[model samples]
Target: MTSPHSKLHISRSLNRFQTQITIFLPRVAVSKMTVVHIVLIKFRPGVAQEHKDTVIQELNKMKEMDCVKHHRLVVGTSITVPVERSKGFEIALVSFHENAIELDKYRNSEEHLRITTTHIYPHQEESIRFDFEVAPEEEHLWTFLPIPAEN
Candidate 1:
């Protein structure tokens, strides 16, 4: 009483089930974790070397301050197209902490204010910052998959 189409559908379903059983799958989970802040800095044109040096020194001092989990300064290695290339920013500060509140504390602290007003503002021309919260996948994806080491 079975039709030829029904027999063909049953054969295809069995083949698909067998194929799925032979494939390996990776395990992944959602993570509830801390957030991170990303800050980008650009300095003024014709800034003196001494001024740049001083500002860097002040920023480095933040390492001693609590709540700052990590901090780094990187000089731009690539230039953007269309825009006329200038000397570029003196430094880029990347900092990480537990949460946004701690980041706010660091931003509003006396030392931060003093450094900005005294050193960074006078010699700086333009600056920009971008902040983002880390997602669960981003917080733990590396643990399961190996990240290639950079040279």
Candidate 2:
């Protein structure tokens, strides 16, 4: 079963390319319009750090796309602790979009292809991508409810 609070909020994205508004019925259905996109990358042997930085720079350019949420696309090197758990993946990107449609636009954009094919894939030994819909926080659900007096 899904949480009720998830149905109380919807995502709206207004931009030069597209404007979208999604609605959810209160307490009965949830909107899955918000999307989180993540990518983890490991470069091949002898790939210079300088090249990696260039890749990150190109990835950051994705924020200019109107489909990206709040310019939330971020790219950085991993600071994972017990570093062994990272399995040699050194670079990562986390981005948010209003919906899957926006995500699709981002994926198919020319900039993404240029960056990946020209800069990323040549040195990319291993890469993983994960995308998912956002869920409402449990704490926010209690915000408007009355609290009983202390017993």
**Top candidate by lDDT:** 2
TM-score of candidate 2 relative to the true fold: 0.69
lDDT of 2 at 21: 40
- What C-alpha lDDT does candidate 2 achieve relative to the native structure? 0.78
TM-score of each: 0.57, 0.69
Q: After the best TM-score superposition of candidate 1, give how far the Cα of residue 90 lies from its true spot, in angstroms.
A: 3.2
Clashes of 1: 1
For residue 41, model 2's alpha carbon misses the true position, in angstroms, by 0.4
Model 1 regions more than 4 Å off: 1-33, 70-87, 140-151
lDDT of 2 by residue, 1-151 (tens): 7655433222323233443445454443425557889999999999999999999899999998998977778899989898989999999998888787689778866677678888888898999999988765642432344658898
Over the stretch 52-93, how does candidate 1's per-residue lDDT look in tens digits?
777778887876667665442223322555334533544666
- Leading candidate by TM-score: 2
